[model samples]
Target: MIGFGLRLTLRGGREAAVRLVVTAAAVALGVGLILVTLAGINGVDAQNARYAWLNSGVTDATSPTAEPSPDPLWGMLGADIHDGARITRVDVAATGPRSPVPPGIPRLPGPGQYYASPALGALLDSVPAAELGARYPGRRVGTIGAAALPSPDSMIIIVGRTAEELARTPGAAKITSIATRSPGDCTGCRFGLNADVLGLILAVTSAALLFPMLIFIGTATRLSAARREQRFAAMRLVGATPRQVSVVSAVESTVAAAAGTVAGFGLFLLLRIPLADVPFTGEPFAPGDLSLTPVDVLLVAVGVPLAAAVAARIALRRVRISPLGVSRRITPRPPRAYRLIPLVLGVGELAYFVGRRPDTTNGQILAYISGILLMMAGLLIAGPWLTMAGSRIMARRARRPVTLIAARRLADDPRAGFRAVSGLVLALFVTSTAVGVMTTMIAERGVPDAGPAARGTLMVDLSRGEAERGAPEASGAPVPDRVLAGLRSAPGVRGVTVIHTNPLGTMVPVGRWHMEAGLVACEQFAGMPGFGRCAPGAVAASVPPHFGAFDTSASSAWSRTVWPAAAISAERLRDLPAQGVLVRTDGSRQAIERTRTALAAAFPDPRWPPTTVAEAGADAENARILAGFQQLAGVVTVVSLCIAGCSLAVSVVAGLNDRKRAFSLLRLAGVELGTLRRVVVLESTVPLLIAAVVAAGSGFLAARLFLEAQLQYALRPPGAGYYVMVGAGLAVSLGVIASTLPLLRRVTGPETARNE
Candidate 1:
């Protein structure tokens, strides 16, 4: 029986190679995304783990604060981050195995160190532990508490010869204490191995896998119903049980799925080299353990077949209405089932929307899922109506003989019409998503005005020594004064805000601290000369809605009793104030408390002291960092889009198989191959055009809401290019489909239809 089944499968598969190829490719595309996404998460997690290991495990470095200047890494090249190494200073209570402390008030194992000026400056500058010996003749060492500071907020303690010497090192060293770090911008070293990346990967990968599974099973069931009607009918005529027929159908699906998995795994291994280059941070690298584990292979091998079996079983339910009543076409179902589906889907969507408010994350997820289901259900329920409309529209433009015939076909079989439309579903979903994401990003935070075009420029103050090494002819690179002067004098130069952004704490008005967990963005001070509107009273607001969080009830500006009137963005601002607290760079609560203390300490001074802008353009260092981050985000988006394109390849091939018969008929009727190919291209282009329009509309609406709700309080409106992401996305989608045009000519000759 197995041998017979195998032989039957091969014979059937050869006849249906085109369909199988497309279906298998789609399956492979889906699987590849799964593996790549998993690998990416692993890579990010591993990198971050390495960073955390270096930061959290070390005793000499803990809860570091911002530096006045950049530091050298590994005692050689300059890096903006505080330490080339993680430094922690643990306070060991058990003095039994005590390591000797250098000369200080007491030889206690609590945090203390000996270091020179340069090394001390470097250590105190950022979160990573500074190179102590580089500054002083003696090496600095210390112990920290078991509880280390959170990443991005962890401070790099400077262990000079004496506490007084460390205090006199420059900025306040006491701020390095866990109680003093800021909550905002505190990624610390832990950011290098972000668990959130893994979470995101899992979420996206699930959708990626499930979506293809849906498409594959849907198309396969439909095709099986169409092509295998004769075979199933004959079996039914020969006294085959309905159950037996169902089993055969399930077996066929399993065979197709297994073949796809094998092909997919092979392709994954073959493409490992290029896939490794997808991540921006690493060199071209593949995982040493590239192959799937036996368990993973088994899960895939079993799970896919089971999914196919389930789909086949469901489809077979419709086939069992009357096993003996066989026909070439299914009689139309009563409108009850078709109409009821829309109502159920619509009500489910409405219920989801109403039950879950858009103001919460749960609500947002509900809204998104509900929206997708409702749209799909509406499309399916209204398929015939849509087809009628499309046919009419095409009929009006069907001056050409071929287009007239195509329109007639569309008007006759709405099911087949939708198959022509299915190609656009993925394109539209991805394009809409891409547009929405990019538009929101662009509108909320305008592109960097690289030149009237330049948004702002930062003047970094390089150490005089480093500057001298770079340019011996120039005097001390006291960049704050020179760069400021140059920027002010340059044409097309707008306003300037010498603000600071780091994974560190800043003083705020309230006594409590808040965390700026993701990143720190410092822009022009409000009302700075040539900059946009900024009042001394206006503060930078980083509210919750800006971070893609659903809550938007928080006030755009807050009044800090300590700082008087200042606006600040919450690392996680929400409608619920009690749930919200003051934030710091490291996402630690201490920064808020410290902010209050700092504000109280510096109150009534003419200039806001602690958080005030230093000399003009002193924040050039921060500008460089923000630029680097933006660049990285852009690179990652481009790479992911490329991955998405590969999925489209599978989609296009599937679409081609559905149209092969029609194309072959056209060829037999003496239509030129080139014209047939163009028609195929035209078929793809039309749907994509419609999808582009829809996606653009969706993106613009979303962007508008995002900008108004989240960004307008702090930034200006977006530029023209901000809206252009849709066009760009459509172009890329079309380009992918266009590349597959050659397949249309495969059936152009006279023998094409006979083979079928």
Candidate 2:
């Protein structure tokens, strides 16, 4: 029976070929996107491990025990690289350069001479290499290899000299104790599910993408199902059994899917090249990072065709392949209102959580998780019901023949209409949720602070306190007052402000507070609401004081406890006891460079180096982490969207032939072409419009509830432009149905109308 099925499909020739190609193309695209996602994950994880090892200041052959004894390698082995105060991760490898470098970067700094990578070299380009010796402590000769890196766009700097000459110089960034000696070649050694939060993020993201893949496959499999049903019904009239017909349908879908999956793999490989160049997870991918893993390959090879077969079987179960059944218009029972139970449950969960004080109790966590699950499940469960309801209402209100025809078809099998958009609804819902949560988190917590440094002010924290917090591999310690005094006397002799801890490690007092709180010094009233008073010596608090709970008992809690306060500034930080110092330098870049040099030169030894901050990338961990999630969401959304788009296109084309007879009869009965076009357009546009509206509203509500539950009451919704973009994308997707309108002309021609 299956062999017979295959022959019948193949014998259908050009018509069969076209259907198979469309189905295959849809499958190929879905599978390809999934593969690309896998590559991204692998690349990010690989880069993380590489950077981790780089920051540990260790490499394969570096002897760990060899210390300051004369034979020492004085160059930096692996060091925590930074851009301004914020760490850019990007490693600095102190190894012999095998690849040639640009003429701009000098030879491995001979003890004091420094050469920069192309990226680093660009930053130092403004300063003359000869003049750099005084402030930078190294004469930059040239830049590192312009093309050596796997991610040519990476900011890797490799600078070192021959063993004998390098040994002469000492104490630069000597590779200290090795943290990891194992080379990162073994895939088995990599972190897996044990990554916890990271793992959950990837798994959930992958699952999100997988849904659209399935939707695409399912939609493509059912394409032309109406025509297939009719053909099989004719077969049934010739004494073919139901079982044989089922086997034929399965065989047909499976062949197309298997071919598509293979093509998809090739497409993925082609795409990986461009995707690798894209900066994601804070870095561009290494050469092989975007390639599929063995497991991913195996899964694609086996799973895609199998899924196709299963989907085909499922599509068949909806309609009987018999002459009598096919001749009769059979309407399946409309999905009931009860189908909305999951959505209702999800909303209830959200309400429960949103009403309570945000806390991390076990119950609260459970509620959050339950809410997420229920929301997703609810969309799936409610989709068909919503489709049916809309169809019924549209049919009821239909006064024209074209509208009536579209409505009746939809009302008959709303499941088919829902199938086209289920993936899109889920994608939008999840993406909006993530964006909303991030906005809330960012708004509530504010940005990670590195004390106060006004723009155009050169801030140098000689204490190394800020660097130590973010950069684990930093060896620099606190600098003494004498060095700071030297920095103040440097050529850029603009007044320098410094903060010092008393011998007791406590922040020095600026002055007594003059506000109602009687707080002494600006430190005591940090970020206090409604307080704009500057402290003595112009010093202020680095972090705002946490005002206690809002109590309604006192003064009826009518008046606000505090009002918005002026932010701490460099002026306010002038005379405070500080662990760090902020400098007000002239606008000249040379002056800034001179100040940085003076700060570094102030440190007689590398042990207690003074660090200078120009501009931090606002690239703190929270922001970076959130950005990663956003990037993932963006990737998944785009892929899901493409798959959804294809699914709809295939869906419309598949059903066009099925509606030919109805359209022909309607045309015969005096329906206008414009009215028929309107019907074709409405059939798809209305359901999609419903999906977009529902998804946007539901996703927003769910995200809002989550934000409230998390204690982030200051809700910052994603940009209003998100809706505009979504609407535009939806409009484009819905336009695909327009292509089917041309087919209407042929199907409803006088010849076809008379034949039907």
Candidate 3:
């Protein structure tokens, strides 16, 4: 009996060609998407592993600050990020743990001994001998390992020394931390041996995206189920046992699914080849990192076929197939209120998330992830129910015969109708959620939140050593006196507030004790706690507990803050105890440029970087990150749309011959050609429109809940552009469904009715 069933399955392939092709395609697409996601993650981790020492970690040899920098990773290289990495001073330091030295670079034996990379050693060699020792204070012992080098052109240097001799060295430590860590590698996967927020996020996003495509794939498999049931019933009447019929059904689906799964693997491999060049975290991916393990590939190869066979069995459970009743088989009275259970559960989870927002803890992250998962699951589970309800509502209000037919068909079999639109709904939901997320993200970092300078304020300051390092043998660096003079003469100069550090190393009598202070002079200082800002004549001192070790409190005009001491003019700098001027200009770009030119003329070779408060390109890195995520999301959406189009086309075109009898009967009973066309159109479109509304609503809700659960109350709705995109997508879907309507006229012809 099984052999007979298998024979029938093989012979019937041509008859079920459309179903076979679409089902296989569905499986292939789903499998391919998942594989690609895995490859990307593995690739990123792999790249890190290949250059483990570089990303292994880095240490800062700087002293502790009262307040930490906002994000240290960003300010890692030179202070002037605009120049990328054109630094004159090689920030090399050592005397720590003996990390694996690169092959070319030898280990240093003691303190005051150094092993520099060839690139760095040359730069040090260029410095004058008299100043070199004072600036670097180390003997070049050997070269660094070439393997440890980031690149031949890198401006960085790592000065390694034996820790035994450096422990006793005073003031030898500062803020030191790892550069590139390998925590992502301990388990050879980004997910670790366990789950983490970053990993969970990646998983959730993949699942959210691919599940819609899966629905389309499932629909493809089931597109001709009605006709397949009729054939099986005929076989049952011919003395074939139910078991034999089941075997045939299973064989057909399994083969199609298996074929599609294999195709998916092929697709994944093709995709993997090019993606290796794509950058992640500012580095290209290694090909090996993007490949799946042999075990993983094997599992996918086996699991997808088995799952398809299982789905085939489940699809046959609802209907009682008998030769006589095959044409009039009953569908279970549409999915009921039970279908709403998932939606109910999702709402409850949403409430829970709102009540207790997620924190940095693993439990919170899990809960947050779970909440999102629930929201996604609810939409999937409730799709049929929503479709059913909408159909019933439409059927009751339907005025035309064609509308009534469409309404009733959907009301009776919303599961089928829902399947047709489910993939698109999921895509739309995810896109909308992304919109909300990105909107909030962009809004938060709208403008660079650098210290003190409000809108339209232009600030210029000189570094401490800018005076002594006047550009190599070319006259002298710009003096504060000339800079202030230029600023005063510049056009559109609204106002100028000059603040310079106290050069006299002033001490004010505080009752019994005279407290030493480094003062900044601001004519009108805007107060910064502990580091004062006030009127022009006010002096604000950022009195340190001990300021001798680190005086780089105000390192650059942009990176840190320098405060006012007693307000003094540049003219009084010689008389008043002081440092170079910290000028704040209340003017336009024209005025700032004029001042820059004037300062350049006054000091022949100034080493200072004169910058402004106006922010531009501050969020470039963040924008790139956002764009990458959006690009991924956009691809998912497009794929979902293609799958949706395929699903709709299959539903409309696949079973025309089988549906001919029913379509003909209606025509014989006085149904006009236009009426039948309307029926076809309504059957496809109502469910589509209904699914769209529900998907959009669910997506918005999820995003809103995400914001609240994460406790980020900032709300930014997806703009009209998002809606336009969704609308355009739906229009295309509608157009595709409509294109298939012409087939109804051919199938419902007088000739078809007479023959049947």
Report, for every candidate in turn, its global Cα lDDT versus the true structure: 0.41, 0.58, 0.57
Clashes of each: 64, 17, 43
Residues 512-548 of candidate 1: C-alpha lDDT, one tens digit per residue? 3444321112233332322123334444422221111
User: After TM-score superposition, what is the CA distance of residue 641 in candidate 1 from its true location, in Å?
Assistant: 8.0
Better of 2 and 3 by TM-score: 2
Maximum-lDDT candidate: 2
What's the true lDDT of residue 338 in model 1? Answer: 57
How many pairs in model 3 have backbone atoms within 3 A of each other, for residues 3 or more apart or on separate chains, i.e. clashes? 43
lDDT of 3 by residue, 358-402 (tens): 555677767756766676777777888888888889988988777
Cα-based TM-score, every candidate = 0.54, 0.73, 0.70
Ranked candidates (lDDT, high to low): 2, 3, 1
lDDT of 2 by residue, 1-756 (tens): 877878877787766887778768867876786687677667656554443333333444223552322222234332222333221212122344332222223433444445555555565565554223353453655555533332344444444355554344332345443323223432333211122345455656666667666777777666666777778888888888877777788788888888889888889877878777665554466668776779988987788778767776777674454466766876788899999999989988888866674465546657776787788888978988898889889889988777787898778888877877777787677767766776666554433333222223444343343344454312334345576577666664455544333222223211233122111234433322222334335443322121111110121121232322234454333333344444545545556556655654553323333333323223344554566556666776676666677778777776766777777787778888888888778778777877777877787888888777667475586777666768667877877778768877876787875675
lDDT of 2 at 622: 51
Error of 1 at 12 (Å): 2.9
CA deviation > 4 Å runs, candidate 3: 1-14, 50-181, 184-195, 277-284, 318-328, 359-361, 446-624, 654-658, 754-756
